[model samples]
Target: AEVAPGAVHVPDWLDLETRRRLVAACREWATPRAGFRAARLPNGGVMSVRTVCLGWHWYPYKYSKTIDDVDGAPVTPFPGWLAELGQRAVSDAYGAAVEYQPDIALINHYDSAAKMGLHQDKDEASLEPVVSLSLGDACVFRFGNTEHRGRPWTDVELRSGDLFVFGGPSRLAFHGVTKTLPDHGDPDLDLSGRLNITLRVSGF
Candidate 1:
């Protein structure tokens, strides 16, 4: 998602060792501590079950069939190395020697068929840039204009180890994952589907 300086891609910010460790940790933490269940949407539909990790297990706005609170999941605290990586991303993008350390690392898991619709990240009080890292299979990222929902969208291919940052004017832009291309992942990564780690400043 392009906010001010347009969509800029950060290449391979995560080293092999760090990425491996992070992925391993996530795998161990995948269990739904809050009891995974389908979530009911405002439209009365349901979304897939998501296991969230806040400081503790407390994800989903409510457990029905579909959960509308995609942002309700626990903000996975970024690992020290990951936090350092995020700090660099912020400094490079904003270019003001900012010390924007992330408090919440929202980890999103997408199976083979699961998909994400266009939506904005409006739960946080801060409008700081969001740093998202993609791992596993490749996925199509649809970034739309901040003012409107559809049209004038830019679809970018997010591959393993790819980094995306969105802030400033395009911070509130509508974006979503169209789909994940199966079997397009790095074998060395050992991840099957799509795992997205988005680092953000939650509380202002």
Candidate 2:
């Protein structure tokens, strides 16, 4: 479904086996040595969800090779397979051959009480479309317009294996996850929360 111009949501895009494999990879990525950790905002508040970066570590408004918020160790390198998956995602979302090479990925784990505010992803140098893949529990994804974070927004339920792509004119749109539906994940997945893997091009 085209939620907006240049924004498309493909439901059940990933199969069960693929979701399981990604979950296992996420577990490995969430370990120590510049792993999944809480992100502290400039306002001195910590984010509800824990995030792990690949390819390039991301601060509030910047991207770096090291996690300045953590031990300054270089974050995990974004795997080539993952980047290929992202390219495939873009092709599937647009129904055409797209020239996308996502070098960075933000892996976020959201618990029951986690909620993301409406914000624009404008910290990158590239205006490439953001590829978001959902796993585990379902969540309410608020897709807002580019003007602001006010009204005229659409709330879409994003479940496991769903793919959402927003780019082109909507590359800087304000969007977020309002809340997650706990215990709504596939029983076979055996996950406690939701996992969102967002792929982007750093252009660095």
lDDT of 2 at 73: 85
Per-residue CA lDDT of model 1 for 1-204, tens digit only, reads 333464567656567776788688777655554333344566787655244343322233322222234434443344666678788877775555878777666677777886778888876768878888888888888989888788988888888888788877778889988888988886778787888877877663
Give candidate 1 regions above 4 Å deviation. Answer: 1-6, 32-39, 48-51, 55-81, 94-96
TM-score against truth, every candidate = 0.80, 0.98
Please state the error at residue 160 of candidate 2 in Å. Answer: 0.4
Model 1: lowest-lDDT 10 consecutive positions: 57-66
CA lDDT scores, all candidates in order: 0.69, 0.91
User: Could you tell me the TM-score of candidate 1?
Assistant: 0.80
